[model samples]
Target chain A: MGSPAGTGTGTGLINGMMGRNNIFWHECAVGRGDRQRLLKQKGCVVWITGLSGSGKSTLACTLDHELHSRGKLTYVLDGDNLRHGLNRDLGFSAHDRTENIRRVGEVAKLFADAGLICIASLISPYRRDRDSCRAILPDASFIEVFLNMPLEVCESRDPKGLYKLARAGKIKGFTGIDDPYEPPLNCEIEIKQEEGACPSPSAMAGQVVSYLEEKGFLED
Target chain B: MGSPAGTGTGTGLINGMMGRNNIFWHECAVGRGDRQRLLKQKGCVVWITGLSGSGKSTLACTLDHELHSRGKLTYVLDGDNLRHGLNRDLGFSAHDRTENIRRVGEVAKLFADAGLICIASLISPYRRDRDSCRAILPDASFIEVFLNMPLEVCESRDPKGLYKLARAGKIKGFTGIDDPYEPPLNCEIEIKQEEGACPSPSAMAGQVVSYLEEKGFLED
Candidate 1:
């Protein structure tokens, strides 16, 4: 949601990026703590996994809106949009998909290192792939938000008509059809899109923001 | 250098990244303009190229200091450190080197897109490689700063003793030794190491910030 705004001290930024170059490798410099101090908030990755039409993007965007309104610094790494640029070289094959998540995970870590909340929304389908992302981040820096929705409901939404294509046998290895969607076994947060639990995207966003606030991730 | 501080309008940020999901591909969403306005400054890539020991990193760090003091947003992408992570799969071979620059260019573009002043300091030995980086960016967004330090001077200032290693044949295909270094034919700015032209790192950074200001790249 919202990005926290501040006029950080020189000491803080220097600590954050001093080693970005090789020349200063020998010198002690300011660090992540300074960046966090300057930004008036901590940095973390919010990873959302769901089916194609599970409203993950909408929820991510709405959360970003909520966070920004609260003065939090945030950026969304939508897996789909990343394919248009950073991961453009990757294909949908299983190996390529793993590389895709790997790269996104690394980039998100870089963003967090620089003191920004990175929201990464991906179908992610496999347990091992998600675990790989979790392994690289700092402790408590990764929050998994699992959107649990029935395949039929997601198919009904069919936001991009992808499910229809998959149904027509036009796209093989589709996540919910031929490809399997491995639900998270122990996610940090879980939200159901079923009858009493699911809410509008904005409401769901509020729920996530509440979790962040409750966890003190939003603390100055 | 200084990154501009801001609390941008939700409307603007929403425009810059709303459809990160595949669902909203039919329409444009949040964009660069929103980011620029929020940061209160234009974003551009400052590509610094020179021999390994030509004070490129020093210049970048001092410039970052100057910019941050002035409250401008900036980040430096040093080549050596990138090899430790993002480009870990790459090697010293010519093909890998080219891929390395290509990936850095892509990353710089993404940073600019997010409205951060990106300072990329790399040996980047070839003009064709630099030009390819320029080709991907928007007009006026790529500011090439050629550090015209002579090979002898760079060799004398071997900050990491890498020059000594190259001279002893401990390293192979190094720029300015066995490998060729095609100097830029028409860079936007050129800072020479000669007595009258090259100032202290801080002063040199002043020269750059002045250029940015004169060109209105620093306009609010």
Candidate 2:
């Protein structure tokens, strides 16, 4: 194991010293600023959280379209959609659900770090998990949009027939049914779809975009 | 549970009654191609893999600088740098190492999917693990650039002193020391840094950029 040729510190090609932290860590690389400069827009995570069938994915898609049409780079990290791919290994168990959100948050942070607006649409029923996501992002980069629709409205608008299964006891621990949904206490935007008439997904998306514009996020 | 008002299905506010498989999964959202079109470039993962101190991160950073100068959207996902943040929970155990590469693979795939040329530099050590990464990307998007430097050469160039620790048995399962680094047999690009004189990181990065250009990945 004692190879004299390799052990000689002075004979090394790069000839660097050996303190664990003393290694020439190249920290100055292409970062968020470089990407944002190239793309001509700031990156952030627009976390859209709501109950099942509360139009989270639809609203994310609508917002993505609005941003893309305006020459802004964006990506949507949809919950159900990711379950078909990256989060396929995760299940509905509490531990698995937490892990699922952690992975999603990490991925969303990476996308934002790469200077692309990331619209993360998940039924992140827990406030702690959402807060953890917010904690990972840069300041003023985590926009939480609570789809403030009533559970009754979401049940009525169950697009995936998931509420039916949950109601029939076929799907256990369904959020807002058998499980509790903790809404965000201090989210930036709140779309009250249950106020009177349900707003179209586009209108809700426009509202969110308007919020971003008002906050100067949509500007250069 | 048997709420007639919610069970009627026609009483939905969104008014979109979807069969279990009929919820037209909004697949036509802003996709990779759309982002590519807007950016005037294609997206791919330029995976630079080798033993520790083989200049993998340096090459990645150099390539990123080159691409950024050329107005290409690029991001570098270095191994040690990420271990401090994203993969902080992981360790150097064989299983943890494999899991580490797996997560990095998934993140790189997401980047490529977002229509950005992602430079992933990691001492991934295992052929099967790396092959798994290649499988996740779309066709011709996984550019595996094997930094073909000898173990002795890498040891001499020990930038992180990780090699020194591994040699002294302070660290276990270090690639090319106590562990194995399976060299690529059929890699897309192999830069022989061991042959004759070792090329500068920028020169090696130029080789990679040239290969990407040859493959039409750097094209509009």
Candidate 3:
């Protein structure tokens, strides 16, 4: 007999069952193309990675506003909001940090598959974890938008005073403080200050929307 | 000074941070109504619950296809597909099952918020877990569809022979065999066999589509 689907023999049985049904299940299922067609736009992940307080969330919200105003479906998976729900069980240990990025990456992939432009705003200092997220989506669909705002600029903004807390040693392992921020070696898009000043939120979102348009993500 | 957003102090800080941002997040963000207007349909979760091998996946696929053909964006959160990625870390323990349902419920809420009709197919055996899932969504948006096919019929179909493995004790704590399945006491929809015969997949999907239409989910 064929391997029983979800025999629940344990974790040992998961591989066999999932592998058996992967191809057949995908064949019978409604596909990403179908969902994209319905939405009239290609689903993609706009992963905004930078140090904490680096305008990642601002860019995400601005991008969400820009896209939604243009009648596109977009959802933001902000790291802060997620900590209250899906990632609540996780802590900020090295292992949990990786797991946190992994779970967020996976969820963003699902949102992309569902035909929404998913904006993921996270510090995501580790390059390996970000690359792993890129590996899950189709080529060009995982648009890694690096917010190249300087740590000095972010610290000065300190819109929520996180930098001050980190400076005071009240918070530890904070990216750009104790933790290292690894810049992406080859991201699809990069947003940085034009001069000594950060670009307006609309201008920042315009850059991404333009990239999405050029890459054919704004259309089915 | 305002509470530092995501100070990384630990889990202790999550509550305070999220509470501060909850109202502001919803206010500045693109609301669900905008997404629904963009998609020309209201977002909602169609959660299908039943025993294993009870055509839950079949109905989910059928509904996905049916909705897609009519130009509605829909996504299925099948228990098996989810187990491979989002819930891979979870096992078959009782606690794991509850966690599984919780995570799926949260993800489904995200999908609905993205303005897609999300169909969640799972052999969720506990009433409390399913009720908790319902509680997380807006009232009347979480439509619980109970597939009331008899366990005998499901065992007879044995599409993947899961019931056979369960019966032979190869899979312990299998729902409707070693374990129990607490059917929904107040599901929004119920599909049961007639004249000792199960309904066709299209018929089952049609029932759900009709309900969605009547409930004004098919249009903004």
Candidate 4:
């Protein structure tokens, strides 16, 4: 018995179902070039990592404000705000931390794809997780900024008393406490919070704007 | 015995221990009026809810484009895009659905509190969930727009083949199929998707702009 006309064996059936079987044909009809042209701007993710109380969220919000003021589309996904929603179910366990960073990385990638600069401020202390995020994004699109405040500095400036609690053994597995913090091996930018000489968040934010401009992501 | 200096059981002791209770003072300093004056605009969340392929996203995006073109600060929290990042782990189950809307609602509230018009597009089918969002936000801040498309019309469009899959039993617990979709009890605006003469998404978007202007949200 012969096979049905539309259901030929193996290769013939595949060809019959797809008709022309030219997967590349649709490339000409749909192009990313139009989206790029419409946006007239490059999109990227600025991943800001630091210890709690190291001014990561402050810097991220300031950068967002500055970028928005300059007519650039920008969004800041902060650690506290994100935890209150997206990462609410996640606990402080090491595995959950990895998952949290993984999820944020994916979301940041989507925002970048949608032609918006996404600023993510998280205390993502694991270098492996950070590396995984960099792997997912395009080269030059993942800007890793390390807020390299000394442990003592962060502890002294414990705005939320988290460091104090960690020290008192109330909070376990806190980064810079019982757990480890693998600082970025080669961060794009590093900000040091000097005692009584720390630059305002706006000043740090200005550095980010300059970086974006130098990288040709923003118009002069 | 009397308590030690700066450790008395009165207002002085309380103020001394909490460092003058900066939280309450900061709350007063950063009141809603202050935020509005600082951002130079009032904040609100314009929530657009409807079934899949019911023009909610189209209308929200159009409104975002229009508001953006006019130099207003706005951002869209689209359902699909958000799921890809912020709410990626959430399934389409009822519990996950509630959590998704709750997260979106909290994020929108934060964005609005920061003095930006937050536009959220979701297939928020449950009236209770929508009501919870309204309760979380301030009065006059939650402007709900219902994309009131009949189920048959939405099914006929089948822009994403979701309705068809639901009907074929390929999809489980689909809203409007095996599940229920409760329309908004008293929505601020309703966009009727009439047969053969549906309003363009841009026109529908313009209606929202008109409402914002009439309500003194946008300068004429």
The number of the candidate with the highest DockQ is 3
For model 3 the TM-score comes to: 0.90
On residues B119-151, what C-alpha lDDT tens digit does candidate 4 reach at each position? 888889999999988877877989999988878
lDDT of 3 by residue, A1-220 (tens): 0113554331133344432332113223677887787778999999999876688877888999999988888998877667666776888889988998998998998999888899998889999999999988877889999999999988988766777877887777778998899999999888898868788888989999999999899999
| TM-score quality measure for candidate 2 | 0.87
lDDT of each: 0.73, 0.78, 0.81, 0.69
RMSD of each: 7.6, 8.2, 5.4, 10.1
B50-70, model 2: which lDDT tens digit per residue?
888787877887899999899
| C-alpha positional error of residue B207 in candidate 2 after TM-score superposition, expressed in Å | 0.9
- Cα lDDT of candidate 1 equals 0.73
lDDT of 3 by residue, B68-145 (tens): 899898888877777777877888889988999999998898888778899999888999999998987886999999
Question: How many steric overlaps are in each model, in order?
Answer: 29, 0, 0, 0
Superposed model 3: Cα runs more than 4 Å off: A1-14, A17-28, B1-14, B17-28
Residue runs of model 4 more than 4 Å from their true location after superposition? A1-44, A57-76, A102-119, A132-139, A193-206, A217-220, B1-43, B68-74, B110-116, B193-197
Model 2 chain B weakest 10-residue run by lDDT:
B1-10
Q: What shift in Å separates residue B58 of candidate 2 from its native position after superposition? A: 0.3
Candidates 1 and 3 compared by DockQ, better number:
3
Between prediction 1 and prediction 3, the one with superior lDDT is 3
